[model samples]
Target chain A: MNKYIQDTHAHVLIWLEEAANMIRESFTEQLIIETKSNFSDLVTNMDKSVQNFFIQKIMEYYPTHQILGEESAEQFKDTNREHVWVIDPIDGTANFVKQQDHFCILISYYENDIGKLGYIYDVMNKNLYYAIENAGVFLNNSKLPTPPAISLQEGLVSIDVRNWYGKASLERLATEAFDIRYFGCGGIDSIHVITGKFAAFAASIAGPWDIAAQRIFAKELGLCVSKFDGSDVNYLKGGNWVISNKAAYEDLLTIVKEF
Target chain B: MNKYIQDTHAHVLIWLEEAANMIRESFTEQLIIETKSNFSDLVTNMDKSVQNFFIQKIMEYYPTHQILGEESAEQFKDTNREHVWVIDPIDGTANFVKQQDHFCILISYYENDIGKLGYIYDVMNKNLYYAIENAGVFLNNSKLPTPPAISLQEGLVSIDVRNWYGKASLERLATEAFDIRYFGCGGIDSIHVITGKFAAFAASIAGPWDIAAQRIFAKELGLCVSKFDGSDVNYLKGGNWVISNKAAYEDLLTIVKEF
Candidate 1:
C-alpha cells in the first residue's frame, strides 16, 4: 500500500538523519586529514567513520540492500546495483578541514538502479533536504516550492573553484554569468540551486555519492540535472554535472556547446 | 579625566549599536539596490540609512563633532577639522545589497586632529572590535592579544576581489600564498589580518573611513599598517593599504619593492 511505502521511507529518512548526526559529531573532534591524489585532493578519517556508520545501519535494517560509499567503495570500481544505498559521508573534506561550514552528508536510495529517495543534510545549518520520486522535496520538514525560473544573467551561479582557474568548460560559463561563488561544498551548492539562491551549479568532477541525493531532490523540485553534454546523468560515474532551473540550464548548455 | 573619555566612547558605542540594529532591520525589509560606477560597483539604500542614523545621533549628542561618511560626506571634502568623525556607515555595501552577512559599521573619532578612537562592528556576528589610541584593542570588551607573526607562504591572505583579476601585485601574492579569500569587506579583512586569521590584507581603494580605526588598532597590536609602497598612510585619501603581522608585512613589501 502507499501507506506502507511512505512509512518505510520515513523510517529510512530518520535513520539517515541520525547517521548524519553521528558523522557530524565525529567531525567536531579531530579528523585524520589525508591527501588523496594531489595537494588539493583531500580525505579524512571522519569520512570513513560516517560511511561505516551508514553501512552498519543499513546492514542492520536491510541486509540484502547493497551499500556504496566514497571511502569504502572507492575500490569497488562499479556501482550498477539494485536496491543500493549510495553515500558520501562528508561531501566537502577540504572545507571541513579548513573549518568552513559549507559541507554536508549526502545519501540516495535506489530501487532497481533507479533513484527512489534522496537526502542531503547541511550539518552546519542543521537542515535536511529530502525527496521521494514523484513526491515533493522538503527542507527541514517544510515542503519546498519549485524554484522560480531565472536566467543566467539574473541569477547567481556556483562554480567549482578548480574550474575557474583553468577549466575551459567552467571558465566559459563564468564569463556568461552575472556572478559566481565557490563555497567548496557540492551538496551545499546543490541546495542553493534548488532553493533559488543560485540559478545554476556546474562541476567538472564528482562521484555518485556526491551528486546522487541532490540530483534526485533537484529533479523533484522541477530543476534540470544532467551531464555537461546534455545527456542523462550516470549516477555511478565520475563526470561533469550541471544542475539549474530550466531556462538557465539551457542557456548554460548553449555556452558549453559553443566552448 | 580617563573616566570622561571612557564614558563618551561608551555612549557613542551604545548609540552606534542601536543605529546598526535599525540599519539591519531596514535592510531586511528590502535592499533598494543600486550601482555606483558599473554593474560591479554596488551601493544600497541601507548605506544611506545607516549613515543618516549615525549622523543624527552624532548631532544629537555632540553637534560640534564634524562628521564624514561614505554615503553623505561629498560636501565635506576637507577632513582637517579638530574633532572630525569618519564613518563608513555600512562598509560592505555590495555584500549588504546581496544579502551577504560579512559587512560592518566603521566609525573613527579624532580629537584635536589626532586619532582618538576607532570601532568596527561586525554586524552579523555582533562582535565589536574597538580601540582608543595607546589603550590597546578589544573585541566586545575582552582585550585582544597581539597576533603571532606569520609569513605569506604559510598564511591565508585576504585580498580585494578587484585586485585578484586586475593587477600583478595581487596575482603574485596569490601565487605565493597557501590560499586567498575575498569576503568583500575591507573592515572585516583588516580585522582578520589583525586577529591572525589572515597573514596579510592589501586593498587598493579603501577610504580613510574604512581603515582609520583598524589601522590604529593594528599598530597597537604590533601589526603593520601602511601604504603598499611602505610609506606612512595618509588618512585623508583613498589609496592602497596593506595590513599584516610584522614578518609578513616586511616580506610583502620586499616583493612589492621589486614591482
Candidate 2:
C-alpha cells in the first residue's frame, strides 16, 4: 500500500471505531425519526448526526476530500476531487428505527474513481469488516479466506423478498436454490456472503450508499457484483445488483432474471 | 405459580443454560451433518448430541416425563401420557450449519395437551426467553410487557418469502402490509414478533418443534397462533400457520388468505 492510502486507511479505522461507539451509545437515547421516500424508508436523528460526525472528521483530516452520504448527499456538489468518500451512516434505517440491531455503517473510500479502502461495520455484533485494495480483506485483523464457490442448487441466498412476491423466481428458488432468507439489512446480509455463510444476496433496489462499500469488498473477495441480467454494477447509481459466489452468479441470474 | 411448577421452571432454566453452552462449544468441533426431508433441511451431529444431553437430564430428574424431540422423534412412540415434552434440539439446523448464528433451541412442556412451560433459547445471543402457564413471559430475568395491538400497515411482518415469490399473497402483502422479510429460522424469526419488533410471522410450513414452544409463548403474550386462513395450528401436523399480534392478525389474514 502507498503511504498516502495506508495512512488514510489507518486514520479511517480509528474514526470508524469512534463512529461505532457513537451508534452504540445512542441506543439509550430517544431516536427522533422521519419518513423518507416512503413510510417504509425511514431516517432518524442519528442518521444525520452520524453523517455529520464523519464529515467533520474528514474535513479536519483532509479538508479537500469530498463526501457523498445518505443523509447529506445534497450538500455533496458533484466534484472532481481525488479523494471521494461514499458513506451510508446507517444502511438499514428502518431496521435501525425498529429493531435497533442488524443495521450497519457502510463506508468506502475511492481515489479518482478507483477503490482504495472499504469498511462494513456491524455495530451491534462488533464486527468490523474492512478491505484495503490489493492487500486482502480482514474481519477484525483476522484475514478472511476466499469463500468456497457454491452453486445455487446447494447454496442459500439472501433475496429481496418484496420484489419476488409477484414474480416467478420465488417459485423456482423454492425448489432450486437450497433455500432463501432475508435479514433486511444489506450490510449485515452482505457480511453473510463475505464469510461464506450465504452464497448470494439479490438486492432488487438499493441506494448508492447501500452498495458502494459492498462493491469494493466483493472485488477483493473474489465475489461477483453485477446487475441481474449479467451486466456490470453501476455502484454510483444503484438498482438491482446480485452479489454472489462466482459459481452461483449465472445460475441465480437465470432464476431471477425477471426480477 | 405452584411450588412444583416453580421448582421445575427454575430447574429447567439451569438446564437450558447448560444446553446453550454445549451449542456454543460445538462451533469449533467438526459437525457431522445429514440432510432431512430435503437438501436444505439439515440435521447435524450436534443436534443429536444436544437432544441426548437434554434427554439425559430430563429422564434422570423426571423419569416418567415423556419426551418428543426432532433428533429422536422416531423413538418417541405416540403416547397418551399426562406429561409430554416437545423439543427441537437445534431449530434452524441449516442456519446452524451455515451461519452458525441465528439457529436456536425450542422446548415446550405440556400436561394433557395444556402448555405448562415453554423455553426458546437463542444460543449464540444467549437470550433465554421463557413462559409459564398462568404467569407471563420473561427474557432472561426481566419480564416483558404486553406489546401494542399493531395494525398490518403499521407493522412489520416476517412472511415466508418462498410462498410469496410464486403466489398471489406476495402481491397482496406488497400493497397491504407495511413490509415483509424472512430469516428462514422460525424460532429466530418469531423472536421479532415476541418482542413486538414484527407484528406477525406467516409460515406456510412448520414442524412441531418449530412452532410448539412459540404457541405457548403466544398464548401468554396475547398473540394469535393459527393457520394463515385463520384456522387452528396443529403443532404436530406442520402446515401453514400465522402467529400474529391481535390487531394485525385479521388484517394480515385478509391479505394472504389465498396463500
Candidate 3:
C-alpha cells in the first residue's frame, strides 16, 4: 500500500515537471491570443498546446486516469472513474495574453474519490505549489507554514467582480472584509488565499479543473474550503466555492448562506 | 528662440531624471503603504517622497518656473505664468503597492500658456515617452508613428470605473465603447492611448498636470484631446477629458452627446 501511494505521487511529480517546461517554452514563443465568450474571456493557442502536452504525457504513463481539461472538457459528460486527472492548462488566460506573467498551470489527482495530489505552477515566477492529502503543502521545495488565523476585518479577499454583480453572496462577504481585490485569475487567487496574501477567495462558476488542485493544497495549509452553502466540495461538481483562513471561514460561510 | 526651447527641455529632462531615480530608490527600500478614502485610494510614503523630490528639484533648477503636483498643488493661483511645470510623482499607487508594476512618472512643461514639452515615464519598464509640440512624440528614443484611425466599436478604451460611476458624461461614454479597462493611473492610460495600445481613454476628473504632457503627445500622434463635450481642455481647471484616435474621438463624441 505504501509503495503504491509513493509511486503515484512520484509519477505525478514527473508529469508536472514536463508540463512546466512546456509552459515556459510556449510563453517565450509569443503565442497567438484569442477571445472566448467576450473580450475578457481571453484564450491563447498556448492554452491548447499546453493541455495537449499534458494530456499526451498523462496518457503515456497513467493511461487509465480519466482526463478532464478546461480547454477540452464538455460540460455534461459523466466520468465517475476511480482515478481522474483534472487540469487547467492556463488558468489566467487574460493575464497570460496581456501581462504575460500572472497565469498558472493547475493539476489535481483523485484516487478512489479522495484527492491524492494537487499542483499549481506560477509559470512566470517559476514557483510551484504542491501537496498530498495529510502531507504538508510546499512552495518550490520549502514547506509552507500554516498561515496565522485571521478574521474578515483583518484580511483581504480576492473576488471576481462578475460573481459580485450576479450574486448577493459577494456583496455580503465584501462588507465583512478589510478589502477586496480582483486580478482575473483563479489559480493566482487560490495561491493568494493559501499564502496569506488574501484572507479568502470567493467565486462562482469555477470548474472542478480550476479549483480542485488549489483546494487540496489550501486544505493542507489549514484553510477551510467549502461551497457557498458551507458543504464539502465535490471534486466532480463545478459550482460556487470559498476558501478562507480558519477564523474567517465560519463568518464568511454565514454571510454567503444568508445570500 | 531655438536655443531657449532646447535649454528649457534639457533642464526639465535632468530634473525629471533625478526625480525618477529617487522614486526607484524609495520603492526598493520598501516604503509604507496606506489607503486614503477607501482601499482603492491607495497611497504610500513614497508618493510624498517623490513629489518633494521633484518640487525641490524644480525650484532649485528653475525657480522662476511655476510648479504643480498632485500632493502639493493648491488651486492654480497664478494661472497666467509664462512657464509652469506639472508633475504627478507616482501614478498608479494602487498597482505599485499591490506589487503590480504598471505605474509611471509624469511631467509637463508649458511656456507662455502653450505646451512646450510633455514627458511620461513608465517607471517599471524604464521607458520614457515625450513630445515637443509640433516636434512629434517619441517612445524612448524612437519617434512614434500615428496609430490607424478606429471607431468606438472597433477599439479598446481605458477608463476609470470610479469616475464613470460618479459622472454622467463618463457613464454615457462607458456604454459606447467596444470594451473598457481600468488601470487607475492617469499618465499610464494617456500613454496607452497615445501609443495605440488603447484607442481612447476618458476620465471625469484629472488635474491639468495629469493631462498636460500627454495631451501634447497625443495630438502629435493624430489623437484628439478634449473634454467629453468636445470642448477645449482648460489647463487652469480640473474636469473630464478624453484622448482618442481621430475616428474614435469623433464617433465617440457623437454617441456621448446623445447620452
Candidate 4:
C-alpha cells in the first residue's frame, strides 16, 4: 500500500469507531424516520447523521477526496474524481430501524476508478471486515483465509426474494441448493459468503455503495463477484450482482438468471 | 409450577449446560454426519450424542417420565404418558455442520398433553430462553416482556421457502409485509417471533419437537400459534404451522393459507 492510502486507512478506522459510537448512542433516542422509494426503504436521522460525520471528516482531512454517500450523494457531482470514497453510512436502514442488529456500514476507496481500500463494519457485532487492494483481507485485524470451494447442494444460499421475479428465482434455488437464508442486509449476507458460512449471496438489485466493499473482498479472497449474467460488475453503477464461491457460481447463476 | 416440574426444571437446566459443553468440545474433532429424509436433512453425531445424553439423564433422574427426542423417538413407544419431555438436542443440524453457530437446543415439558415448561437454549450465544406454565418467559435469567403488536406491513416475517407452495406464500408475504427473513432454523426463527424482532414465522412442515417448545412460549407471551388455516396446532402431529403476533396473524394467514 502507498503511504497516502495507508495514512487514509488509519483515519477511516478511527472514523468508523466514532461513527459506531454515534449509532450506539442513538439507540436510546426516538428515531426520526422517513420513507425513500417505499415504506420498507427507510432512512432514519442516524443515517444522515452518520453520513454527515464522514463527509465532514473527509472534507477536513483530505480535501481532494470526493465523497459519495447514501444520504448526501447529490452534493458531489463529479463522478470521475482521482480520489473517491463511496459509502453507505447505514447499508440496511430497514434493519437498522427495525432490528438494529444485522445492519452495517459499507465504504470503498477508489483512486482514479481503481479500488484501493474497502471496509464493511458490522457495528453491533463489532466485526470490521476490510480488504487492502492486492495485499490481503482482514476480519477484526486477522487475515481472512480463502473459503473452501462448495457446491450448491452442500452450502446455504441467500437471496432477495421480494418481487415475483425474485420469488420465481427463490423457488428454483431453494430446491437446488441445500437451503435458503436471508439476513435482510446485503453487507451481512456478503460477510457470510466471504467467511465460507454461505456458498453465495444473490440479489436482484443493489446500489454502488451496497456492493463496493464486497468487490474488494472478492478480489482478495478468491471469490467471484459479478452481475447476475456473469458480467463484470461496474464499480460506479451497481446493478444485480452475486458474490459467490467459484464452485457454486455457475449453478447459482443458472437458477438466478431464470427470472 | 408443581414440585415435580419445578424439581425437574432444575435438573434439566444442569443437564443442558453439560450437554452444551459436550457440543462445544466436539468442535475440535471431525464430525460424523449422515443424511436423513433428503440431502439437506442432515444429522450429525453430535445430534445423536446430545440427545442420548438427555435421554439418559431423564431416564435416570425421572425414571417414570417419557421422552421423545429427534434422534431416539422410536426407543420410547408410549405417547400417552402423563409426563413427557420433547427434545431436539441440536435443532439446526445443518447449521451445526456448516457454520457451527445459530443452532440451538429445544426442550419442552408436557403433562398429559398440557404444555408446562419450555426451553430454547442458544448454546453458542448462551441465551437460555424458557417459559413456565402460568408464569412469564425469561431470557438469560431476566424476565422477558411481551413484545409489542405489529402489523404485517410494519414488521419483518420469516418463512420456509422450499417447495412451490412456500415460494408462492413467500411472494405474498414478501410484498404484503415489511420484508422477508429466514435463519434456516425453526427454533431460531420462532425466537424472533416471540421477541418481536419478527412479526411472524410460517412453515409448511415441522416435526413435533420443532413446535413443542414454541407452543409453550406462545401461550405465555400472548403470541398466536396455529396451523396455516387458523386451526389449532396439533402438539403431536406437527404439520404446517404459523407462530405470529396477533396484529398480523389474520393478514399473514390469508397469504400463507393460499398454498
The clash numbers for all candidates, in the given order, read 0, 0, 0, 0
The regions of model 4 sitting more than 4 angstroms off are: A164-168, B164-167
Of candidate 2 chain B, the 10-residue stretch with the lowest lDDT total is: B159-168
**Residue lDDT tens for model 3, A1-259:** 2676678778767777777787777755867877777655667888898888888877887877788888888732455667788889999776665455667889988786777789888887788888878878888879998987878776766665433433455556555666555555788887877877677887766888878897788767878888989988887677888889898888888877764
RMSD of each: 4.0, 1.8, 5.1, 1.4
Give the better candidate number (1 or 2) by lDDT: 2
Query: What TM-score would chain A of each candidate receive against the reference chain A?
Result: 0.91, 0.96, 0.90, 0.96
Pick out the ten consecutive residues of candidate 2 chain A with the lowest summed lDDT: A72-81
Per-model TM-score versus the true fold: 0.82, 0.95, 0.75, 0.97
Each candidate's DockQ = 0.23, 0.68, 0.12, 0.64
Model 4, position B139: C-alpha lDDT score = 94
Question: Clashing residue pairs in candidate 4, if any?
Answer: none
Query: Total clashes, candidate 1?
Result: 0
Q: Please tell me which predicted candidate would have the highest lDDT against the true structure.
A: 4
Best by DockQ: 2
lDDT of 2 by residue, B65-105 (tens): 88888888777755565888889999888888888888889
| Candidate 1 lDDT, A48-139, residue by residue in tens | 77788778878887777777788877544344476778889889876565543567888888777677888888887788888888888998
lDDT of 4 by residue, A128-194 (tens): 9999999889988999899999889898998886653344566678778988888999999999999
- TM-score, structure 2 vs. true: 0.95
Give stretches of model 3 more than 4 Å off.
Answer: A1-44, A75-82, A94-103, A112-159, A162-181, A188-202, A220-225, A229-235, A242-259, B1-43, B98-102, B122-159, B162-181, B188-204, B242-259
